[model samples]
Target: MATYDLKGKRALITGGASGIGLGAVQAFLRCGASVAVNDLADDRLTAVVDELASAGHAVVAAPGDVGNPEQAPAMVAQAIAALGGLDYLVNNAGTPGTARPIATDDFERQDEDFWQLLVNVNLVGPHRCTRAAAEALRATGGAIVNTTSIAAFRGGGSSAVYCATKAGLVSLTREWARALAPQVRVNAIAPGLVDSDWMCRFDGQDDAVRMGQPVPLGRTGTPTDYGEAILFLAAGAAYVTGQTLNVDGGLTT
Candidate 1:
């Protein structure tokens, strides 16, 4: 058996109905892991699970708003129950708030509601979910892979709050790695300008051409791009922890 073998391992992914999260779910299933997906859209969740089941993979649907404090724990519990035990946790749920240049005073003036929503979903939500699953993760000696973004480092992706929240997640990854050493590993991936619905919303482009222009790679990243990096961090990077892998196709450069 391969040392990176995920066969029979159980994994949980937040925001797994679409985009990078869905890509991660597919990758994990391909590696023989039973996957549990959590997302906000009920119909999308049901449809995704149905597709996976038809493909002969075990999948659990756990739909809810991860940003809600109570809901994160409930989803974790549901996944644990369905999978029998947890071996991996992918904190992939995130949202870009109103995108604007940092120099604009309007961007700086983030009202309480805007700040709260961005921070809760991008940062605190993962914190809550990981905390809830810590025991199960430790018991299985599993790993956690968070989906952070280059905005965390370079700034100016979406709203100011969104950048701050992603930066905070990088901090959380290191914090958890240190605190949970030897029992569970914690890491994150900071992608730069991935091609997703969020990008479509941000750029008003229905296709990849407009989205890929600015990047040095001459293209925006696909979900499969980050998906591959994430699975490597989870299954193959056993000696790795407290690290943030950049899957941005050198966009930051």
Candidate 2:
């Protein structure tokens, strides 16, 4: 794992209670950054904060629904206030809205309400947080790293709606990079085959083996696999912006 001297830095991670978000949380905290873990108001959110706090890490719970327009910016503001200021924002909050992958032609499942929900959290949610945090980040010369997905680059993911939102995020990453340039850096990561809680399953006896067989690396990826990448983009990679790093284990190759 990559390491950095983040003793006085502060960060905010949305959808941070589990999976890649949790991975980033542990990475930032391990490197000495104070973090505000954002998620929906629920027991899982409280449990994560309590666990991290008990471990002596500087973590506070910033619970709200990223899918809710009013709650999104409000949560970012609260997180910034609690952490004193923000040096980094990881827009990792998103949902596939379904456990199973929806076919490209499944327009019924990809209805108006479904698209709106995905767009709200996966696309518009980051915009809300970035808009709220732009000034703070600019003051500190900080950066924003969005948790996009390999779905944005390829034909497979949870659903067409999910892919559309993630792809839109990639466009936003570049646009925001230009908009926030010379001040706050903007970038993204497109993870592939990560064995996170977001929903990857197989009925095979060895799901990991079954799922990872097609990848050149021959294994599924874990949260830690992405945590390292997040660490680099957040605290290192000073000159890199507007790019989406593929953190897959050679899956796309």
Candidate 3:
């Protein structure tokens, strides 16, 4: 239905050069949205921007480290300028955090730096982006769809920090939803195990095996699965906010 149509809407998606973020970018474009894609990788950003621009899509690359407190605001400003305004934001950046259980003595024996790195990237990163984008979203009556993970609801992912930060994101979604109020809608998606190159970072010996060992789904999810749900939250879920939709193939249940 046209209720879900996002034609002419402007979107800012973090980590849009690859993985789940890139998948959301494609779906948004198909729904007729102008997009500004953000990522830390300059080359990947350029390539994605060029490809989409060539196809006559209003897409631009906003290259900056989201984990950098200063860079987040700058990236948001650039997205506003490039896309003319912002209507939707997909906060999809994430870090699996070296792919190890935090309970392991080896992981705990590492150092504080490891934990801080995870917090900065997995937690503060999205906070910075959302803070920077909040004003723009409010002005346009926009929506913010944060990409969390099933790790937020379950304890079986990367490490203590990753899961904790994702859970924090879920809390942020609920708080921002009420704070932004009848203006900018804030929500989140907590996806199950997604089959992407990012998964390669976990259990390097065999990514396939690790992914397949997940819940009733019998297999891992695809980026598109999460991407479509993102689109729904951004455009279709008009009456929804302060909720974290779990796209985990019924994993949590």
- On TM-score, the candidate that comes out on top is 2
- Candidate order (TM-score): 2, 1, 3
Q: Each candidate's lDDT (Cα)? A: 0.86, 0.89, 0.83
Q: Which segments of model 1 are wrong by more than 4 Å?
A: 1-4, 98-105, 206-208
**What is the C-alpha lDDT profile of model 1 across 27-80, one tens digit per residue?**
898889999999995788999999999989989898878899888899899999
Better of 1 and 3 by lDDT: 1
Q: Taking the tens digit of each residue's C-alpha lDDT, what string does model 3 give over 169-232? A: 9998999898999998989999887777757656563774565665677767777888888999
lDDT by residue for model 2 (97-146), tens: 77655665676668888998999889999999999899999999999999
Candidate 1, RMSD to the unseen true structure: 2.5
Could you give me the TM-score of model 1 versus the true structure? 0.93
Give the distance in Å from residue 223's predicted Cα in candidate 3 to where it truly belongs: 0.6
Worst 10 residues of 3 by lDDT: 99-108
Tell me the number of clashing residue pairs for each predicted model.
0, 0, 0
